[model samples]
Target: MVVHSISRYLLIILSLFLFSLVIIECKSIKFSTSLSPKSLDLKIEKLTHLHFYLQAIIGGDHPSEVKVAGPNTSFIAFGTLEVEDDNLTVSPDVNSMTIGRAQGILASADQNELAYLNVLIFEFTKGVYANSTLSLLGRNQIDVPNREIPIVGGSGVFRLSRGFAITSRIRFIPNSSVVLVFGCYVLHY
Candidate 1:
């Protein structure tokens, strides 16, 4: 009988000791300064995609000299965004760097419905020189379908749990006859 009681007490003590240890570990905390106390809200301004396919046939007129421009041509989307009252800085997605023109445009519409626009043009010449056999390669220009557009601005409230909210306006330009389909995912910090 005495041995049984002693064993019971010992078991209780062991359980208590393990429970306290778990509580201590659970109470222990870690700190990081990389986080910001401020809150933010984000929304999508605009997202669009355009597909172009063209085939040039050599039939009636073959000039004495051959001329080749870029392999193909297409326009990209460009736009500006206003986020709430806070100042915003925009950066390029390096992976999006294209061998052809990549355009970014941001536009604003006033009460009168007049649009003011800003344009970013990335014209690449890599494909143009690929086939150098042609005597004359002309400069190629890719323009956005709607060169001018209205601006889109939005806001949403976010807290510590939400981390950062990102709204983006992205466009893709393909310079080939083959159908090119692309999907993009963005992660925010």
Candidate 2:
């Protein structure tokens, strides 16, 4: 009877000790304040306007765009995904001044309309913004004129870049290729 009592006391003491440990751990957790943009000394320097053309060669022997995964029904079928490394040029002509490449995946997310969820990186290889990249994530309604896409972020000279790209279909060669003009207004440091 005495041993039983002792074991009960010991179990109760261990339970209390564990509970105290948990309380101590919870009390020791320090909550930190999130750093604000101003506290980080981030300043918006300039609003730069960039104009370029994206030539997506969808067909031919060496195409820049390829359908990666999708149903066999149609190209614009919902959930269809295509990957592209389209050339960025100064003009609509593919042979114009080569500046960069728009590399990303385009997914057909709309069933009723020809809309694509574009997640692209505009990688500049020439001119003043060489070696810089701007990330774009937005919906592109192909039928709409001047479809706007948000420039979420960037790297290199385009660090902390935020902007919108006005994209318009310049030319569309049926089953061959499509040329799009992108006019971006970016605000960055």
Provide the TM-score for each candidate, comma-separated. 0.24, 0.84
> What's the CA error at residue 154 for candidate 2, in Å?
1.4
Mark the regions of model 1 whose C-alpha exceeds 4 Å error after superposition: 29-34, 37-189
Q: Which stretches of candidate 2 lie above 4 Å from their native place?
A: 1-6, 23-43
Tens-place lDDT digits, model 2, residues 1-189: 999999999999999999999999999998987887677577757999999999999888999999999999977889899999999999989899999999999999998999999999999999889999999999999999989999999988898899999999999997799999999999988
lDDT tens digits, residue span 31-112, model 1: 6445333433333323322222112111235311122221222112222231111111112332342333323332332323
Clashing pairs in 2: none
Q: 149 in model 1: Cα distance from truth in Å?
A: 16
